[model samples]
Target: MKNLIILLLFLFVGQQNIYAQKTIKIWVVRHAEKDVSNPKDKDPDLSPLGKERAEALAKYLKGEKIDSIFSTNYKRTRLTGYPTADKTGLTIQTYDPATHSELAKNLIKNAEGKRMLIIGHSNTVQEILVAFGAQKPVKELTEDDYDYIFELTIKGDKREVKVDRYGAEHHTKE
Candidate 1:
């Protein structure tokens, strides 16, 4: 019984080592532009421009080591994250769009010290950024916007956010 208890303690500590709060980077973006031809379709596929944008994003982050990819259960979001997932050879994990807090916890739990790409919608991106306690993050994204990226570096209790743009810049008419 003493030997068994000692072995169990060793196993538990080994498992805990994998979950140490190591610094990590998380890139958040709204899904690439979606097909608007079928205006009535709730889940339209990615538009040609969107596909190109997704490829661009993958190329832009090619040098980084992506450990995970996440997206909502929607054609557009999945397709938007597909390029990165393919490049990283990582499967895209689907999460409920409304469960922002749970998603944040999942990222920290599964990807400690790793990097990830989270594909989200314009509105949901705001929620995700908020869940990370991002600083100076955008509150909302417009339909015409698809190039912004919210890059976050998390170290223990500190989260630093940086805003960047990928692919062609969206020109919102004044």
Candidate 2:
């Protein structure tokens, strides 16, 4: 019995080390609120509230060694990545929405062995999530909703992603 217990403890410690080494995390967030000052209706930069939220997000990600930053070819998404990128010294790569799938595929290919943060709009986030092989589909996420954060972990052929609602609880999807 003593030998058996020792063997099991050794195996548990070894497994923990392997799991720590192989784990990778990705954080996906919607761009912060936008300015509506331009009554003429053109895309504007982040509003004051948006700037505050962006700063909050930067603080939230301070310690993580973010490898790459990816965003859509839009001002909002670029602005969202700015504070974090400034802190981490990671350059932001712009992906065109017209070729969303292609951009997503290339991102996953290039991000192998590295952690990435992707900022996108409400409409585009779900599409990219699907491209990443995420099984659950968010049917209705609006611009006012800046709540859901998608956390994804990929190792070899296996993929796991969970949705974390900002005001609520995190749930793992099937």
Candidate 3:
């Protein structure tokens, strides 16, 4: 009986490892809404509504097992990640905007089957999407836009891109 129990335990562990290797979910959020009204606000921070949105975003993501989080060197992106990181206990990685596409590629390579979140700007996010070969001209996402989650599913040599846009929305290029 003991031998049978040990075999069962081993099988459970093996199944878990297999699942870990099969799938990864990635959440890409445009930085929260910024205070663009202030001409003096050279470096715009999250506006009041933006802060609330961040809190809502945190609540929505609280239960997910997010393995990694990333943000631009900018304060807005870093701040946008704060709530999620605090909830998930993951530190946000800062990457340069100029080299963002390369950095994103490296991230996908290293992430393997683990989930990751990358927070970025309107322009930089476009480059990131291009790097993933998900789409071209990746559509400059803005603070006013809480677009959708870019879900990439990888199995062996096959990769698929699906967008789970907010409010079940979809985008078509002009």
Candidate 4:
């Protein structure tokens, strides 16, 4: 019931911004689950469920008209966004994970009034969200967390965020 309300709110807002020239809409998501086969591997690809989650992400944003897609330079993050890029005919651009503030500034300045999708890591998403003007406290993403879609709408200095879910419901691994 909570997700349904959030989804409805997101859809309503999404509709309102489709043709607006002064609003910027950004959907920030953590990369889907990665392969844990090689636990020591610094970089890894998406696991089978991750791939399915990727597809679900794409399908969820099918008509959102994303103007750009951004991802960290890791296989897991790249693949998490690949399905959406492929479906939308947009290429995934890489950003330096360490420069979260810079990336937020660049996007606000250059990509104004456009919709974007950012696929980031658990540790990076919160920082990026803050840089884009999220004033309230946001929880850190845990290893077991992977289903949040941080919907952001920016107009000049004002930014509104809505946390919604996409793909299958993820339960925290206790």
TM-score (all chains, Cα) for each model: 0.83, 0.77, 0.73, 0.84
> Model 3: residues >4 Å from true position, as ranges?
1-21, 136-143, 165-174
C-alpha RMSD between model 1 and the true structure: 6.8
Clashing pairs in 2: none
Give candidate 1 misplaced runs (Cα > 4 Å).
Answer: 1-21, 172-174
TM-score preference between candidates 2 and 4, better one: 4
Compared with the true structure, all predictions reach lDDT values of 0.86, 0.75, 0.70, 0.89
What lDDT tens digits, residue by residue, belong to model 4 across residues 1-174?
Answer: 999999999999999888565889999999998999998999998999999999999999999999999999999999999999999999999999999789999988898779999999888887888988875336567887798888989987788989878889888434
> Can you rank all candidates by lDDT, best first?
4, 1, 2, 3
Model 1 agreement with the true structure over 1-174: per-residue lDDT tens digits: 999999999999999988867988989999998999988999999889999999989987898998888899999999988888888899999999889779898777677778888988888887887787765486557888899988999988888988989988766534
Model 2, residue 34: distance off in Å is 0.5
**Candidates sorted by TM-score, descending order?**
4, 1, 2, 3
RMSD for each of the candidates: 6.8, 5.7, 5.4, 10.4
Candidate that would win on TM-score: 4
Please say which candidate is ahead in TM-score: 1 or 3: 1
Count of clashing pairs, candidate 1: 0
